[model samples]
Target: MKAVLIEADTISSAWSQLIYEIYKNGEEHKPDYSMSTRRLHATVAINDVDNNQINSFVPFGENLIKKYKEELTEEYAEWYISLPDDDKRKFDYCYAKQLFRYGETAYNTLSENLKNLRVGSRRHVGVLWENEVHIPKFEDQPCWIAYKLELLNETDVLLYILYRSWDAYGGFPANLPAIVEGFKKVFREKKLPYRIESLIATGWDTHIYESDLQAVEKIFKIAQLCPKCGNLTPKHALISTTKGKVCTQCKCRM
Candidate 1:
């Protein structure tokens, strides 16, 4: 587990810098920096309450940095991250930064998802998802799913799952939470874990909009980083074009 304590000028700037750092370093290369979550990006983030600024930090699986630390601004408050490799690039970044779980750092959102789902074996399953957040505050919809679990010989743990009923880029926030909460409720009643051995996601494409970039920034600014966990932030400034934002660091699309 690696950790980086990050400070930002307006919190937004800090997070933006952090996200750019991670996007550059992830395993997969996203040519379209603006659209790809795999690439560096920033979102609204929050640091400890003392000072309010966008909070963004990246984590490394291995000891990528040993005794590495620095203050970006002159007051030593905040600025874009900088490493020894270059004068312009910041070194901190990750694709998925696990924030907090049970007072400890989490690995990925999927990790907890697997835990709650309990990896059950099902003969068949169906998943329907609508992932858009309406601007006018429209009526809410729910995704429908069907599941049949074979328990022992005769007993069965049956369930239906939905990641999000609405259509939005940030579906994971609402959908993942719903799934976890549902799992908790079912686990209490059934006693046996609601095992979801298989999942059948509908043919869908999850994407980020240039218009929603600001919303993403605000989210990261408010989003808290889990201690000892990688907090991948998004880019602070992104103008949506058919062409994706290119990483100044890696010379790849962010």
Candidate 2:
């Protein structure tokens, strides 16, 4: 498997670079289904996750983030809270259940682990893929596998994410933010005195589908223009320009 390692100042920047690298150097291949692309195995590291620097490369904006947050963490109040865990393994797999809402959520489990952690402990981890449940079925199985949080010091935590496969265009953008946000919630609720030190994401198969090329090009264009505005463009909006890049509301005034 070919490899690409990207280190960027922000998650959006890292994601953009990953897409561009895959576009340029990814090997062409066919997938199990119709949509295919030049793909590669890669690991991405974002030193900082700017709440404001969400990438224009993503096809949609914060709404996508909201959707993913619910899917991955079920953070919203309107979520299906009463549904029982499937006993027969006959129901289709739901990633959120495996991650945050089954008998014991990954967040719940990790919080317990962190609370009991010692200064030099190595057990801060959460898992989303279970063999008995996922191995029997194929639909809606999780692409994200597991994550680990390592306490580096008294005031910082290092997060490592593992994805069995990732869709660079849509899934990754949503996955990264939702996971980070979920961690923040856990840390805060647990009252752990730790801030995110760094985030490292490893994906086995990361690729852009051929059909999404037009949207990808649009994102690249937006990334190029951000520097003109001091990089303050909102995470996901159909942006326009005045003297420089501005949000649609700002553009409306001009």
Candidate 3:
């Protein structure tokens, strides 16, 4: 088992560093399911959740942030997860709604407790997994397992998260911000003065799918067309090509 720890001031910075770290050092291991992916474990801590500029890096629609943000709430979770047991079997994928909703939602419990804003109370925790409904064999399950908040002071709230599984490329970016927003909502509803002091996320199995390898390479590639000569060169290099010495900018390349 390999462990990676990343600490950054913003979600974007943390995400960028973690991606590069995994690409450089992650090991390849076959998952239980038939998928082209390997697993790695890492812990990431971000000091600023409000600075979410890294959302731009997500190839998918930015709307996914909103969608994931909703998923962190009890209302959305309850709406999607109210199906009866027999009806739940009809769905192929197990939704997080089941974990966050139908079960005793952590948000509700946390909100109720925060009314008093008691510091150093270990009870400021929320659970997502239910042994009876989830522990039994199922095709898919929620990757996020639980969340806890520690009121370090009257104005600082520290968040801690546990993930049974994590997708570094796609899931990590969205999940972190959304969880922060979700917790912020809890703090706001309680009318308590608070700042997201710090957030720590731990993943038991974090990985990227093999199918996305090429996309990852392109993201970090340094080669780009020389602005002047139109010849490909390392983005930051002065290259001596048949066309002549090409600089990073058009005038030098031309």
| Better by lDDT, candidate 3 or 1 | 3
Q: Which candidate wins on TM-score?
A: 3
Runs in model 1 deviating more than 4 A are 1-120, 124-168, 193-203, 217-230, 233-254
Evaluate residue 47 in candidate 2 and report its C-alpha lDDT on the 0 to 100 scale.
Answer: 80
lDDT score, residue 56, model 1?
30
Q: Candidate 2 at residue 146, lDDT?
A: 84
The segments of candidate 2 whose C-alpha lies over 4 angstroms from its true place after superposition are 70-81, 84-93, 101-107, 218-254
- Report the number of the highest-lDDT candidate: 2
Residues 1-254, model 2: lDDT tens digits:
68999887778767767887887788877877558776899898878864544765467888878776666554532143445455453345456555565443334556566777565667878787877777786556678888887878788778888988788877778878887877777678777787888899999989888888676666555544343222324345536554645655445646
Residue 227 displacement (Å), model 3: 25
lDDT of each: 0.31, 0.70, 0.69
Q: Which residue pairs in candidate 3 have backbone atoms (N, alpha carbon, C) closer than 3 angstroms, thus clashing?
A: 228-250
RMSD of each: 20.4, 6.0, 7.4
C-alpha TM-scores of all predictions: 0.29, 0.76, 0.77
State in Å the error of residue 15, model 3: 1.1
Better of 1 and 3 by TM-score: 3
Q: Output the TM-score of candidate 3.
A: 0.77
Considering summed lDDT, which 10 consecutive residues are worst modelled in model 2? 225-234
